[model samples]
Target: MTHIDSATAGPVSGAVRGDGLDARLVVERGSFRLDVALTAAPGDVVALLGPNGAGKTTALRALAGLTPLTGGHLRLDGDSLDRTPPESRPVGVVFQDYLLFPHLSALDNVAFGPRCQGASKADARAQAAQWLDRMGLADHAGARPRRLSGGQAQRVALARALATRPRLLLLDEPLAALDARTRLDVRAQLRRHLTEFEAVAVLVTHDPLDAMVLADRLVVIEHGRIVQEGAPSDIARHPRTDYIAQLVGLNLYKGRAEGHAVRLDAGPAITTTEDLTGPAFVAFPPGAVTLYRDRPTGSSARNLWRCEVAGLETHGDQIRADLTGELPLAADLTTVAAAELDLQPGATVWATVKAAQTHAYPA
Candidate 1:
């Protein structure tokens, strides 16, 4: 495997030079084809989010020149790196496992990158010391990978990547290895470091919280293509696909809209506040759904469906019930309510949602 290191190389193509990162990554393996176009300005942190087998890793590998692109182009800081070797490209990667050499101390590990780039041993060590100090790991400089904590090792890895002064930085699940308590502290610290970075940073992560917290913009990929891209707030408010909706914790349905009603493709019609024609999407938060053991007569809710509890799980102090029936959806209720309703798999219930709670947008 080619490790990320700094190298001086000329542009391989006559393509117009552009600032930051501009690339259309295309990779083909067997029947899987990944085609993703990514552009980021200097100092921008973009997060690539997707489910398993969604090609998130493939796209990251393509950008780092680890997985060769069968098509598309790669450019960074006005230089075309389409044909640049992995060791020759000015790209730095912080792998999921941190990938620190067990035999090297934290300081030596950080210095390794600059040393490989031909910096003098003294200069490389000096630079590494500064980075360790910046990462607040100066106290652990002499510690080996086994001695450092998860968060400390992650910072060391990041310091090592940044030591090369690469124009494009790639972080693969940088916080995935940390424990919940450690992840909270490290995530905030990582955000600060990313903000101070002057180069383009691309992070691939499966955790929605990681993406929403660390990235300035989010690019959601599904089955090898970008399903949606936008600010975290915007994407959270309006999701275009089921994958995105689920990620943001919203119940989404696609249908044809006529006035205040949308006839869903899944054999149901939803009432929304928006009036429109043609294909549309209606979405509501799981909390907006109310479940009842017996159907209530003369309820004010505009939408009601007979549903059966498919499963139940605890979601942040609330009981999240997955229902399958008239309209497959999820509902969040207090534990007390769950106990009162006797919610369990195979239990029949009535689900209700007020029209005001549903938002509809053009598809």
Candidate 2:
């Protein structure tokens, strides 16, 4: 299959133009401008992950030519698609809500793309049947959009997109519309389909787990900018920003690193095994924290801070305590320990963490 390979027209400065889809999209509105550069090779599954309104959808729209770029360039398969209309682009998009036509049956919906491209009615139906059969929805080909379940509708949307034989596929929160129970099953099925796609695929999702499971690479965006891009495991182990740290469930602090100790800007200091200078970030999991009702005597822990219980909640089988004081952090403890210590909001406690438990890296 001939897919988007490479292009050099209106080359973007510092843009990656190796193979497959290469784009440097810039959209300018009053008081807000989204400028993001994206590149994906053939058979690569990339996920655009970020908080809401971080321009993920805008980037996807720009790639499909649904949204015009005020600056920068978009190229696919050695062809400059900067001025191409949305329908002409060799791209397919699966919207968050599926966006299936309510009046159309599953077979008709899947056949619509081929029919629009001048395929005969009989041929379109035949091709559509093949796609529906692949999606395991041939039994429901006569069912209308409203009659199908959430997972079935999602599969139909995917079939419709794939029926066009697009070189680039874009999925925006593909499982967001389904309930939690249905999302699990649909996610696994979607992962299987994505693995089989032999073209550039980009999926937009805010859920970290979904992004990790679906995409080979993750592009984290915030405030219309790409902050971090790497493998999911690397991003989880070393978060560059507090937003990412929070999303990955870690307590992150910025400080000036000394030999084996770092003095926090928040008034407390922490000791770590990492030896560095200048600015640094110290991160530790909530489970690393140990709380004591009274100051523990002769404790070997290098980091100790007096904090008040700001809140308490159940996290899995353990209780997570939100603390605030000299150093704000979260502590997770067993329910038995919480009951024994009489932990509650507004109660003062001493939190300790060993130097070995903290991971410090240059910021």
Candidate 3:
């Protein structure tokens, strides 16, 4: 119960740290190093969120002693944990792939942790059964990892990690393997379970939606350093990094505003809603755009630009196009629409956004 507390049940910020998992992590390997500090309270689900190679995984690995630290310290419930080995650390890790034994049934996998912690086999199985039931996996106890679905396997993984009764629980991209449909269901269930846990739980993910939905607070890292950290809602409202802004699907532009419109140094001039007279940030959602390869004769969209298609990636049934020219921006278009337009990299295109779609605020 040291990692999170019931007193913080109302509302709290990222500044809220408890007498649970306190970490000053510094791990160096050649040019790559991770220097980060954070704390998570009992029942507090803190997410380590960032893009790939942003040191999110490195930070988690360092805390569990899976990776050696060149310097810094870690403590759990006020006890120093500098020299603790991975096995000895009071930590339970649920890897992204679950890492469940394929041959063992769900019951055996959940029991393995407690058994390793010196509980009798019968006692371990008993405790494991209880954990499985709590995870809503009682019916799947006899199912093997291969037999279970991704969401079911994840629940088993959680039950196994929690069975050890570790003070600090760690999960790395726990729901990344599931399909979007399954992810939503699993994330809601996981949130409920995390809320009930009376200890610190830290989860790592690159998906902004997962981090926002699953954790009380977020600590974002990039290039081995903490870039931004705050409550999910706060960080979403005020993202300091362009990366964070882009991840949240905002059309962020660093430009100067003379009147109602702002001119992006890289590409386009946008008519904004905010009345600014100097340098400002103009942001719009990707959904706000209406695209046409040819310039419109009399379109309502006031902000128009000539851009070249840079790339395209699939998001569900939609194709997200990356454009370059007046400005580099990502646009979400349906796959059928993209095919109909004959869109490809290096193709010239015209993009437009309504003034209402353009939101301008102080930088």
Candidate 4:
């Protein structure tokens, strides 16, 4: 669907690598547990993105061997790691809070990993210095963890993780520590480093923008399970659940299809461009929906669902109307349009959207 030239669309430089990480981790803590299956190809950076308490951290912890699995398996670079311990696995982790030792200098902190792996103190510090140089922290290598800025500490944490030459890199809320202004700068730097890493890297984040910009694919977890997993842009445009829909601020409905439209058995008859004639989904941004108190006469829009307003709320400068009738849908209207219609909860309304504005795909 893009106009990009074919020559510009060639594959990333390198031979095709095998699936970098193939894992099915089942972890339990108290009454809460996580059962997740995830796979990432070599050179791929997948993001575990979800809301708070959605098991994003739990899943990442499982992968890094920080949390023991009740069952399921883990494989990395085609090798089985069924019994690998956290200290033994070729995995590197950057914890949410950095977890850098406050008493250690940035160089010593990075040196710890290689040192624990049996490198001599001199050898470890030499490798650590090289990593700090690679991370552009050569001058700050002697600085203690508490003295470094947040972004600087994060870079040191990353350098420490990479010191061991890990096959699977795990990052938990990597940018959640920085200020908003620093986040932008660190994000760009992180993206460049991720692109250069030849092995698989996984990061968990709650920020949608971070997931979209830093990952090749996003694995969305809800209720301890993966609710959606796909390229970031795809998930953004077609989310499946109310949480994801609201997270992305789009209207989504599932129903039966016939020709260019899908009739929601529970809601509305929505039209779309998909050619399939069976079960499908029709989705659009709330902003694409138009609401009117009275149905327009001879309107060119082919789909119209009459409904009663259930609730109304302000979304930034726009108003979002929650409707209940033939179909439940969220429609956005300008303040002026809402005032003109005198829209309120329990008010009767007609929602219309053209087929061209609607997107339909397989559910």
Ranking by TM-score: 1, 2, 4, 3
Question: Which residue runs does candidate 2 get wrong by more than 4 Å?
Answer: 1-18
Which pairs clash in the backbone of model 4?
267-326, 267-327
Q: Give candidates' CA RMSD values in order.
A: 5.0, 4.7, 5.2, 6.5
Across 110-153, the per-residue lDDT of candidate 2 in tens digits comes to: 99999988999999999999999999999999999999999999
Best candidate, lDDT: 1
Global fold similarity of model 1 (TM-score)? 0.94
Give the best candidate by TM-score. 1
Provide the overall lDDT of each model, using Cα atoms, as 2-decimal numbers.
0.89, 0.86, 0.83, 0.82
* Model 3: per-residue Cα lDDT at residue 87: 93
Local accuracy of candidate 4 as per-residue lDDT tens digits, 24-125 = 777767767677777777788988766777787777777777777787778888787877888899999988789999999999999999999999999999
True-structure Cα RMSD, model 1: 5.0
Residue pairs clashing in model 1 are: none
Clashing pairs in 2: 4-77, 5-77, 6-78
> What is residue 333's positional error in candidate 2, in angstroms?
2.6
**Candidate 4's TM-score:** 0.84
TM-score of each: 0.94, 0.91, 0.83, 0.84
Estimate the overall C-alpha local distance difference test score of candidate 4: 0.82
lDDT of 1 by residue, 30-49 (tens): 87878787888888898888
